[model samples]
Target chain A: MSAAPELNPAIEVAGLRKRYGVGDTAVDALKGVDLTVQPGEVIGLIGPSGSGKSTLLKCLGAVTEPSDGRIRLSGETVYDGGWHDLDPRALRRDRIGFVFQAPYLIPFLDVTDNVALPLLLAGRSNREARQRARELLAALDVQHRAQAAIAQLSGGEQQRVAIARALANQPPIILADEPTAPLDSERALAVVRILNRMAQQYRTAIIVVTHDEKIIPTFRRLYHIRDGRTYEEAGAGRDLG
Target chain B: MISLAGRDILHSWGKYAFTGLGLGLLIGVTLSMAGIYRGMVDDGKALLANSGADLWVVQRDTLGPYAEPSSLRDDVYRGLLGLPGVAHAANVTYLTMQARQGKREARVMVVGIQPGEPGEPRYLIAGRQIERTHYEAVADASAGFQLGQRVRIRRHDYTVVGLTRRMVSASGDPMVFIPLRDAQEAQFLKDNDAIVNERARVRANPALNRPGAPGLAETVSRSQESSRMVNAVLVQVAPGWSAAEVAETIRRWKRLQTYTVPQMEEILIAKLIATSARQIAVFLLILAVVSAAIVSFIIYTMTLGKLREIAVLKLIGARNRTIAGMILQEALGLGLIGFLVGKTVATLWAPYFPKYVLLEPGDAARGFAAVMLICALASTLAIRTALRVDPATAMGG
Candidate 1:
């Protein structure tokens, strides 16, 4: 019940590093990345292909074991030196969310099932999971299509369902990879506005990785990753209208 | 937890149904093979039951008169009837040959029995049992013969006087009953040219012609012209007499081979048709292996198609057991559909086979259990694939 501005910072990363393979063939994907974001802030991550943006996101999400780093989320130290204190799967499930460039909704499931899956996986009863999913879907203005198949929804509607799914578990941080890259300029800008509103309303910090020129200026803060390194910068933060 | 497998099946029911139907046809063939074996066993039992004889007295050390050839004297039944436990006995002959009705020849077991005796057809569906001693015959309904129809057996033509059903030999040959005298003549009667040759040879033998007696050669020729051999004696034991006792008594005192009803059945099923049973069993085994292989390949391919989805699920806190359960449930569903279709197809086509197809309820029930077990085992390959999928794959590359 805390307001977005009054909440503490949700993520802090320092000197994070990641490498693939081993010995002679190892390739360092993330060299030494450092960053932080307050709760309710919508930040942008921009970089060319193979510039280590994905590696940084993966380290932040705890999906890969970082070679060296310290990561803190919601005032808790989740990793340091050697993945200090949390089960990676539990950490990802209970503390983080994800949104992809494509909706990636399971084709077999309906909109409600796709949205409620994470909550169900977290051990919630079906009724409880469905109840939480419906609230988020309604907030995102896609509740009318709750029973529709994932394939039946339009591109924009499917993306809205994906955003609703990321919010269903009420995680402290969300990592979005090219959330609106496939949309038209107007639709892309509309998606950024929705992300900002969702962050402020839910008090969740969100990092969106994008190369879309149309929506890059919508964030107040941004990070530019190049050659396995990161640099912070300011965005336009101006209203789309 | 949400049911991943149930959702997938419901989403693509048409594809699953069509695949299940194809699998069902294969399953149907397996069931039919099993039915054919059962039918053979049933026919063996029915043949023993319909004979209405307490003991079969044949030539010493022979498996006749169904499984092998044995030629006992036609008058042996007379000596058997005077035994302590004997009530009635009759001469019976069996010959497997083609009988011509109109222009078509049907393979039949030509059974020659005494009229008004225990070895004749028990009851008739049409016409009467053979009334005339020499030229009348009683045919099984399956032989496609009608009353008063003339059927040719070898060189002789006989009128069909009666029709009966379910009277078949162990080899599935329909039975045609004729008088014992006629059958004996047809089974061993030689050609006229051979008889003529034999007569010339005999007339020319000095030991037989002996100039002292001119009629000796003619007398030997007349004896050769007549046939007198019979297959076996079908005997009915007296009231309160045991078939085993009678058979043992005949074997010991009469110095003849005798078999009780059960022993005859064993010979027919275990010895006569054992090779065929083994062949069918091998076929059933092959079909089972083929079914299992198809299930494994299908499940493995399906799991491969959902690699990304599995990774996402794993990242979102799905347990390994839940994933495995999903794959197993899908396999069970596939098996359920296949079994229903297979059972239906087997039942629908059973009667059309040339032989009886006995699809017992017990066999069907066993088949269902086997299919479920096979499906469960087959899903292990898919489960292993799903479990090996790394959750890190879901992160952007």
Candidate 2:
């Protein structure tokens, strides 16, 4: 029900600029970045350190405002001349999902509750939210561990649960900042494989920010960022094992 | 919404419980301090109530019987008995001294009470009241005296024939009631050597040793050796008469210091125990400050420890109110646990204290409210810290 329109681009950004501080001391973190992603696509944003990948992700996630940009998410203008007529907190809650290097699942909550938290926060009934979470766990192949505490899960299973959490609210865009950074090669590839399958199945666009070499070739498209700008590249789209 | 605070507490219950236990001991000390003050006030009231008097008559210009020294002729009660509206009046003496039983001694208020009169203790728990004129005594149960125990006061050893409960002085020393003649002797008795020296001084006087006054010196010596003074006269008014009227008549006509029951209660509680009450008050304030500081430090440390998680929750769209609420709820939870443990601990240890510890329900309710309020205020620092955590912190550089 929260999916984007069938034909429109899932995310749109043009001349997006972000600056830290103000007046003479202000330093630009993101400048003139343009990107677009249609529904049901998973792309990579790869660069060396200090390339404004995080800054751009912060802008896209609505956590930080862009100084100069025309941004749209799920066919709605989120940041234009200024902020759009929508609450940023609600936008992040209902429209955007984030996956960091660590799974970052709340340790106090069990896996099912962790995945179900987003829905609960959006005012869904407990039974309905948990039911949806179990469905997602089954799809991610962690259904057996749904009732377990987060500490009891393996690294791969925790990441899977984290992805399920991100998908709970059915956000059209999931900005993954190095979701596989702490994993071995096999686990990293498996995470990418899971992301691609989720994107196709749910018609969600995912932007994975990574410096990992093992999963880089799996993206059909890659946005190589340097000096706060992006240069798109085609990937091998190799068959996942 | 899910109760984030509840989940967190359940996850780390041991940490919460142990911390609460430590805080509970502090709260227990605080409550016990308050109980001590109440006990002092209660002791003063008990001293007044156990005397079975409607009015107190002492020497003029003195705080009679409990707070200050006073003395009057032992025969003053006869004049008081003849006064209009006076039902009964009897002489009573109060002397705080150490009573010895062989090797054991305890501080006691030795009260010289007239038998079958207004000064007798109201009820007895063991044995009979004083029947002898010289040496029978009734002891408070708290004095650790048994029936038929020989209690030595000054040079004379008396038999404890009766026991009473809750009969204490304004200063919390247990009461030991004896007959009036024995108490007067104890108050005015001198050593035989001093008596002999006094007798020699009296007989050596030329006017007294003259033939016409041959026996006068001996009579004077005997009179000097005997004492007929009492500290206060306890008066009971007739059923149809007002004690205040009788007290006023005594004060104006007889020229004596007289106080009605309520006025005497005020003197004993307000004047006698004022300093101890203030001391306990100072202790209570210090304990409150210490409890607040400990709670604040604990909550602040807990908030700091979970900064990362807070940042993640913020980035995931948890509101500022939600995060702050979690911290506040946790602080209150700690206070509730602490109060429960403290109340139980205070009750369990109250009897072991040397002084009577009176834990009133009203004071306990007020203490519970104060603790909850302190906890709520203590959580503010942690709440502020949590709110300042930037949502962007969850997105690492």
Report the number of the highest-lDDT candidate: 2
Q: Which 10-residue window in model 2 chain B sums to the lowest lDDT?
A: B205-214
The candidate that achieves the highest DockQ relative to the unseen native structure: 2
Q: Candidate 1's residue-wise lDDT over A22-125, tens digit each?
A: 99999999888998888988899999999998888878888788899888888778888876767888888887888888877788899999999989878999
Query: What lDDT tens digits, residue by residue, belong to model 2 across residues B55-161?
Result: 99998999987889999998999998999999999999999999999899999999998899987988999999998898999999999999988999998999999
What are the per-residue Cα lDDT tens digits for candidate 1 across B171-281?
888899999889988898888998999999999999999999979999999888887788889989999999999899899888999999989989999999999999999
List candidate 2 stretches off by more than 4 Å: A1-6, B203-212
Residue B98 deviation, candidate 1, in Å? 1.1
Evaluate candidate 2 and give its CAPRI docking class based on DockQ.
Answer: medium
| Per-model CA lDDT versus the true structure | 0.88, 0.90
**Against the hidden reference, what TM-scores do the models get?**
0.93, 0.96
What is candidate 2's CA lDDT for residue B194? 90
Tens-place lDDT per residue, model 2, A12-64, is 99999988999999888887899988888899999988899999999999899
Q: Which pairs of residues have clashing backbones in candidate 2?
A: none
lDDT of 1 at B314: 76
Model 1 has fnat of 0.61
Count backbone clashes in candidate 1. Answer: 0
Model 1: residues with Cα > 4 Å off, grouped in runs:
A1-8, A81-87, B123-128
Clashing pairs for model 1 are none
The window of 10 residues in a row where model 1 chain A has the poorest summed lDDT is: A1-10
